[model samples]
Target chain A: MNRLRFAPIPAGLPATVPFTGPETLERRRGAPFRARLGANENGFGPSPKAVEAMARASADVWKYGDPDSHDLREALAAHHVISPANIMLGEGIDGLLGLLVRLVMAPGETVVTSEGAYPTFNYHVAGFDGRLHKVPYRDDAEDLEALIAAGHETGARLIYFANPDNPMGSWLTGERIEAALSHLPDGALLILDEAYAEFAPEAAIPRIDPEDDRVIRFRTFSKAYGMAGARIGYAIGPAELIAGFDRIRNHFGINRTAQIGALAALQDQEWLERTRLKVGKTRDRIAAIAASNGLRALPSATNFVAVDCGQGGDFARRVLAQLAAQGIFARMPGVPPMDRCIRISCGPDHELDAFAEALPVALAGARED
Target chain B: MNRLRFAPIPAGLPATVPFTGPETLERRRGAPFRARLGANENGFGPSPKAVEAMARASADVWKYGDPDSHDLREALAAHHVISPANIMLGEGIDGLLGLLVRLVMAPGETVVTSEGAYPTFNYHVAGFDGRLHKVPYRDDAEDLEALIAAGHETGARLIYFANPDNPMGSWLTGERIEAALSHLPDGALLILDEAYAEFAPEAAIPRIDPEDDRVIRFRTFSKAYGMAGARIGYAIGPAELIAGFDRIRNHFGINRTAQIGALAALQDQEWLERTRLKVGKTRDRIAAIAASNGLRALPSATNFVAVDCGQGGDFARRVLAQLAAQGIFARMPGVPPMDRCIRISCGPDHELDAFAEALPVALAGARED
Candidate 1:
């Protein structure tokens, strides 16, 4: 029963992570899942140029990546038409959220997020001993207005909003976010999690304003750019707020391959466009498959689609387990109403073929159960 | 100035990073360094197998790395002959230090380390608003006894000691470390940073017992493994102490390429041993070069040699700047006494030749200054 002395918050906390990765599950199942679609990772892959760049960079992996991430940050700034000072590159969006939470959330400070939104953000809030206030999703979308209201109600220091959100694949318009910015209370920072922004529609992505102090936007190479394994992401906000990350961030955290790979990915806008189109098609295919099975697939602006199983949480859980039993990996929202639907990520035609073949079988099993 | 609310510590803190990277200096100077030897990176380079492994992993970058880091951790466990439960992987030693500091040192709590020893560790403690008490290096080596005594005096939560220390390239015997562990008072953890352990002599590396609760050991691929840019490191300690990291660490922090690269690197111990021998020879060459110039090279059990300019900090600073002016990027320690010596990493013959060509001229320039 010997234990090392740790901060009270971390000491008392459970060692539960937000998601048990597919690899962990595969080990438990004693077999690899046929489709690597869970976790919302893109299956179409990154730009050939990025893979080439990473392979080229491997020879120089003996040197530490530039700590300032100077070149990558500069490229991101130009790509987004903002000053480099307004950007801070981090390990990933998950890692950046951890830093953002740490920067503003002192012990007992309130942080507001949608109840079933990104759980990693909640993990970080609790890591820093911040009090969490969750506003439930409204009609399957992260209700931005409700999130703002909850932030105000709790006197929260930070509000988490993901445009084209996870699990549900719902989105809010840029106008909705821009108009809502007016009431961002003093002393509160809105963390706009735009990890999947590229897959989201143009209307869902608000204009960039580096001078905007009330909100910070996070974007990653993980989704539409198809570089989730690279672990590269950046935050754009007011220069002062971005500068605050320099106080606590792991300056050398970005991998050398990630830097070069991400830079190449940014340079390949054509590839990004093509991937977006492919994701759109695959998302449609998934919805069609769900419809054929007598399920309703929700509209999606992300690379994933949520299909209502025409059942409650219990039946949805059984369907999900059946999908796993059929060697198809998929996920669902953890909490109530959202859990009544099964989530599937957009994948290549072959993987989608596997899902297509497995869906009816999994559904039949769920119905039998 | 317009600003968002930040935690008290980060709010009051200067937006300073531990190391202003060599690339930042190059940008300011409008040139790249002729000799890439300042950051203690193994310019000897990663194994071709590792490079091949990373290049191979590039196409798979669409998948998030296993959050559990299952295969790599298992390989590392077998490599170190320890149970996997006793290990936790991270971005690097720098990132792990941040997590460790967050886990143990709440605001105002004390942590101890040698002055001018691994500023990044100090940076993490400061980021967490922990009070830091530093004991001056005894004989240009981290004074283990003084550090342990200082822990008692300050009631510090953690004590940091680097084997084959950075900036100065000195080490303490494992027997010395084992003897000191007896007095590591309850509630205090000793962070035994052996980042350069692979390059150190056999006697210097202590046998690790994962059941030991008094200390945690950190190792990185950035040192002798020659994968500095890959950003993979791991901590080993009692299962309980290691589990604490799961509560705060970025679960998916380890990059996919880094995992595969490190695993490939571990499987190629021949490459590691070859790098170690090359480093030893390079260290000898660097020492020989210093001796030929009438300077003294400090005893080293590392990939780098710290050469005394036979003067004070001011003279060494001049030598460092002169090297910079000559496009030779060398670094000196930050505090006095240790500051009298300049550090040079072991690189290829050509880079050391550039250093050889520049050292005497730089020394002459320093003498004149």
Candidate 2:
């Protein structure tokens, strides 16, 4: 019984879990959902001055946080004008994409992304054994010139991409991600993510050159600073790739009440423009509840929407198993023609009136199976 | 300017930080230190029901936390009677020692540890290029048979130790770490680090076999459950090495108000036995203010003490720079005769009366240099 060995890339990995938490499907449906609207979080919360600075930093949680998250990286380098050595803060954006795939991918290198993007950055490029490369999603976003020609045909030292996209809440604009930075690939690096850069459309946020060592970006007090369970996030690059994430991070891996609740949710950018007008009117009431259940919704800039579900992916997995048999958690897109779409998220209108009363009885129980 | 490359073990490491925190020396001493007692944190706080469950989970910080921190790992597996599949939790114990040195360190493997004990586990075994070794401190504790004879003379593969030790808060008897696990090294493993297992000494806690795949332990809601800025911790072991930390943790890196303030600071074990009788009366008032400044103190079971300062390590680095020129933040020990001591920590008598009124003016300004 002498097992305990492991390190051949986590013994050829496989424990996986890049997203499942709806409290493990309400502890396997012992109740509790009635529409949480799957993980793209920001359930319309966070900046009541970042929940009063995380209840005044929870009685100073016995102190250790400032592992140089120095006043939240000097208030995120004066709110992104940059240069707190181009900010780093972590433990989110899925721990800064597993420290930017352990500081630039090395094990069997190459990375790219897109095909059903952000499976936690392909579970941190297969927990660092790297060599990923997908790049499909062309019409429904994230296909920046086929991920810069699959990072110039796989010389890929990391690419990723995201920008207002996630399970089909497509986008692009910031001058087409600054004109796909002259088709990247000469020493790769891109990443970008922008975890729904505050529900997009500030011209979809491009203006790069934070010392552009090709791109890094990230961003995320978990979507529109609603503080996704306050894990914190940040990246913005090039101060030598954000000081090469202090040569391997976890320096007090964040969380002092999520660095004073993400510095009172970045000094309340007026509660992030009132959570971007409540996620643009809950993304137009989830596209008028997917056009009263006939479905179609898709054109989102973020805060989650998707919809489609007219057919395929086995009728959107039987309309997400009849919206989890009416309790409703909702999620979709795991490849295949974008899993005929479902997604959801933009919460709070009584959880979008319990997802508009569980979407026409989950589309007539997925059209009577 | 092409430089964003890295990954050859973070480009041969170096941008280090294995502890420099006291808010970067109070922002390079522009003040603010009247005794924070360096990084052995827990200034005796935390469970007012985990600061009322982190101010009632700060308005449910928009979901995301339960990335399966499933009710604080089923209340730390019923407070360690074990088997929540032998637990894991993380983002602290310096991020589960950088995901247990990236799931058992491969590149040039090796490991061991002790010399300067926890420099964040030798900055994650030199950020995963591993090959560490160290093995020194014997009388000041942690030598565990020269770290199991340097893990059977460098066949190493992770060793680490730490029981009630750190710097020089010496300890040993959990039946001398369960009789030094029959001199380990079979497949190696060990790790241990019971982050001051609640100010140690329940016979220095050592009844192993939680399916001992040789060992694992860890612990910490940041020491004596005070919650070190709520980074959380955990570990335990065996269930297939605690499910090889989901093959590479950061599963939404826990922090829903630190998993509801560490499950209300682990169901308040009477405020962790009243923070171990206020860190055993502030470790006997820091060994009676290091014997009224003549200086000696050492023998501690955690919550910090050290002291020593009779000589060398340049008179304990001139009495830790005259206790940081009077603001008194205090900390020492980095190899050598445990750097002729200095440490301190156990606080709350008005921060140890500002470290007993700046220790005889920092030992008369380090005996006039």
Candidate 3:
């Protein structure tokens, strides 16, 4: 039998996933997690309007979604006060990141990011056979200076920076990001992932020009709008760069129900604000729970809080495992310093109560270990 | 502003989409299509069970879909009497095709396909900088022998062939495809797009070994399953090849509602059989309508009927425009010889009635042109 010939890049890569889903873990553990807090999904749920829209659209799934995503794009453009041409909707931030990497980073070209930034972004870079230059996080936040330096040193084509950082839930002021933009390497494009933008303080939201060629900002319904399963996100960039996505993107890839749901979600700012309040309260509840358990919760602007176990990475791992064994699903950062914390997403009160109940037992188990 | 540096492949490509969706056309025309038939979507709709499942799943869209798509894959595997490892689900066939091209076709590598075959597949090839070797259709059907011959000549890495061919609604017997398998070029893999397979005659549905290394069969919920808007599809191939998708695919790309909806759709085979019966009736109704309008409807093993306008490509195009002007959405083949016909999808009786009402007027208008 002839060997199945794969392109050199994929063939050389390992068959690995960025993250193992909680569902897979549940199957393995032979029980479901009582409190689903892993993956940073917005457990406050999508807008009631969005859910209604999706449900209503369910029967209409016979028709293909508009390949142009015209209405949704128009609404998003209006919401962002940008031209429709400046926005490109995709399956998710993950899908759009893949396209962005493919468009700019040729094989062996370099990209720079903090060591423990988004693994999915790293996965896309590897998938495209792009070399990654990593910089360590500074004070548990993505170090913009270090990243820019690495980009300059490596002559990288792209630099990825996520604000309201995952795993640690640390953030920088928008002014800081705006100031750092001018320091970007000459040829490198900055990929600003604002997946948690809705949860951040207004001061943390950058005010970059939509036509800015140096950066492309990605936002998702998955995090704040609570539509992760809908698989929809959009990137705001220069018109030309946005148009470039059409050259390679799957034109009709967006799900019809998702498009409708997202559009409705965008229109319901009241629901979004309500969700923010719920998330804010949940964040506090989580922090209080951590305090009770003798662990410190890092200040968080996003829906998830990274609670410092006050121990090293190994201790945090043990705590996370114990939490899982106690029917609580949570994740910790993979790299050092950040891995001293286990990330927990804000959910409804009952789920938080479950987490509150589970943390002490988990910490005790980890201490015993 | 430094010009955005795109990788060589995309930089050289035109910003063109595979198809201008019906919605885009409606926007341009300042009117909605009375009958949405142009995209070959299932107008009969998904199973009620599937619709209910999707609607119920809407509230849970706050969580990311199981990246593994375990339950759906398991059901599909059981239904096909194959191992789950043989199946890989994607956003849609379009998304999977893009991944497949990226996985195998290196820059400037050759791929073979029928000239006017699924344009999305060709779009992906061009996106990846793969050279496409086109073979002309034989009697309005994809020339399998010629495609294999071109593959051999070009030492192509992939050959894309669709069963129950689109645009012309032509198909070859499964036995013929089984015979052609042995004739594939040494290194080329066959991309057997069975998107229309459920609507095809039983004899046209190929029964190739699931472990056949040379062929990967793509099936979609978009067509007969009535879930085009849901964006779910699957590919059946050798286990190793199926596993290769994990190396690059967006793990959480599938919509949560779509996964649940598709699983339910798969379970409701009775609904699918009923849809097939309805499509058969609709095909005959379209043919009868064509006959009344003094046109010939080609024999179709799929949901849509290709009605020869008894004119050339230009005249057929004019007729299509006239139908569109009358708020009827229909499409014709893009290439010559086959372009003498306009394709109409199987829709509800009222939609077919709208088409029947518009056809004679369209024919007269085209004659005047």
Candidate 4:
């Protein structure tokens, strides 16, 4: 049978996902994992208020969500002390990043990111046929300076920098990020994916003027608010750049329950604080668990910890495979250096206990292999 | 401050939505509407089982939905008698349409659709820089033969045909659509949007093979299943064409609640039959209401009735505006001819009563104007 043809850009593109979901792994393993720590999801879950809001709004699913997401944007505007025009909501930061790339970079234009910063961003860039330039991480954190230099050298249209980076669970200070602004090329836009912002120290999240046209900052209910499955995220940036999103975005793409859930999650600051405390404690516990197995847990400001396997990326792969084999779902980075660590999300005590019990056996298997 | 530049395509693209949502109008009016008969949403509401499923899944929002959407897809596959490989889930038909356009049409490639069939489809085409050829509707129904001719003439890569059409609520028999396939350009792919299929007579739906490479059909929980706010829709076609979706789609875009809700809703086919019967009754009532107002109601298979004001587009706009003034939200088409009618959605008795009460007042106001 003759196959339908793809456009030039997508013609050569592979059908792939950045990370294989634990559900996919569970399907492959023929059993569910004891510890659901692979996808960086908060196992403690969203606030009770959010769950309540979702329940209240569940019946209203017959009605379409407000296409403009007016109320949510207004609320977010008030939260950030910025005009609603500075914000654009999307499926998630991953979704917004795709739109951002589409808005700013034509096919064959350059985009820059750290070697293993966020594979989803790279996926978006590839989707648009943007030439991606990877800059290696500096001491585990996203090497902002090297990224800027690469952007300048390549005449990049956009640069993706995530605060409290994924995979390796490392972060750069807010001051350093602010300081790196001077090194960016004149025309390049900065995509600051602060998906993990709430988990980081306040000092690590710079108070950028929302009016600043050079940068777009993304935040999500998926992370700190523990609503990943809701697929709600927003980007705040210059009014003009933010407006660019409307050119290509699915205006009514966001779901009604998600709008309600995120709003309720945002309103409950007390619950956020409690989740933060819980995450911090769980991170320490995870570190202790790693230490007991002669592994070093890299410091993490986000909801996940990256434990260096004290070997190379290959060894880390074996460790990750062994963990999955033992029904403890964890993910390791794909690239070198960063791949030397296995990433584990902060979950409830029971989930963490499962990881604790499974770690020794996983280590034993890795060693035998 | 300097603004970031948009890519060439988006630079000239307008940020337009298919319709101005009722919320926007309500905001402008400084109050809520008495009845929302616009947007064609199932105001009769989703099944209780679907709501229960959503409520159950509400707390699980902390975990991102299965990127593969394995279970839901498997269920949908079973329901359709197609392999899961023949199905691809997305945020909505709108989102999937965008990805489809991006995948197949390179910049300046030709795409054909009814002039005002679905503005969202045209929006995606424009976003991808596709050259759009629009054929006029013949007697308030999309001119399928004309569309096929235009596709052949222009070497259009895609031809969009929505069964049980929106706006005018007119439809073509499946036999006619099947007969028109022979005239399709060799390489052209047909996009059969079956958004209102359940409301449509089965005879109106073509019996195309699931693996038929010539056409792809879209189905949504948003319409018959009554879960628009959930934003879950799927495309069924040849396995290769369906696989093309993953090349650019937001893999994790579908929300958790939606996946569960749609699955449960699909399982409860009894609610669907009841809703369809309710819609049929409502359509008759709306026709009677239109006749009372000295207007003619177009025969409709979908959840809405198109009431011709026995006037032109200008008169319909006046009627629509007056309806808004009277706190009834009804919509009309934007182009000539079809714009002669105002569309009203099926709703429960109280809402329809509100529309009935407001209709006379709105008509009087329009006549006075």
User: Per-residue alpha-carbon lDDT of model 4 for A1-369, expressed as tens digits?
Assistant: 142888889988987767777788899999999989988998989999999999989999998999889988998999889999999999999899999988888789889998877888899899888999999988888888889999889998898899988877778888988888877889888989999999999888987898877889999999889999999999999998888888889988999999999998989999999999999999999999999989999999999999998889878889889888888888888888888899999999998988998889888888899
Candidate 3 lDDT tens digits, B1-369: 363878888898987788999999999999998998888999999999999999999999999999999999999999999999999999899999999998877788999999888889999999989998999999989999999999999999999999989878899999999999999988999999999999998999888899999899999999999999999999999998999999989999999899999999999999999999999999999999999988999999888999999989999999999999999998888898888999999999999989999999999999999
Better of 3 and 4 by DockQ: 3
Q: Where does candidate 1 clash, by residue pair?
A: none
lDDT of 2 by residue, A1-369 (tens): 254777898888788677788888888989989778888888888888878878877988888888778888887898777789888888887888888888877889888887888787788788889888787887777788888887887788878888888888887888988988877878887888888877877888889978878888888888888788888888888887888888888888787877887887788898789888988999898998788767878889888888888777888888888888788888899878888888988988987897788788877887887
Please list the Cα RMSD from the true structure of every candidate, rounded to 1 decimal place: 1.3, 23.2, 1.0, 1.2
Estimate, for each residue in A1-369, the C-alpha lDDT of model 1 and write its tens digit.
Answer: 133777877886887878999998899899999997788899989999999999999989988999888888999989988899999999889999999988878889998899888888899998888998999999999988888888888988889999989879999999888999998777688888898889888999887587888889999999999999999989999887888898989989999889999999999999999999999999899999998989999999999999999889999999999999988999999888999999999999989999999999998999999
The DockQ leader among the candidates is: 3
Q: Model 3 over residues A1-369: C-alpha lDDT tens digits? A: 364778888888889899999999999999999999988888889999999999999999999998899999999999999899999999999999999999988899999999988999999999999998999999999999889989889999999999888878889999999999999988999999999999999999999998999999999999989999999999999998999999989889999999999999999999999999999989998989999888889999899999999989999999999999999999989999899999999988888988988889889899999
- TM-scores, all candidates, are 0.99, 0.35, 0.99, 0.99
Docking class of 4: medium
**Runs off by more than 4 Å, candidate 4:** A1-3, B1-3
lDDT by residue for model 4 over B1-369, one digit each (tens)? 244878899998986656688899999999999888898999889999999999988999999999899999999999988899999999989888998898888899899999768899999999899999999999999999999999889989999999999878899999999888877888899999999999998889988898887898999999888899999999999898888888788888889889999999999999999999999999999999898888899999899998998889888899899888888888888798889899999988888898888888888888889
Q: What C-alpha lDDT, on a 0 to 100 scale, does residue A193 get in candidate 4?
A: 90
Worst 10 residues of 2 chain A by lDDT: A1-10
Which docking class does model 1 fall in? medium
True contacts kept of 2: 0.84
> Is 1 or 3 the stronger prediction by lDDT?
3
Per-residue error for A58 in candidate 3, Å, reads: 0.6
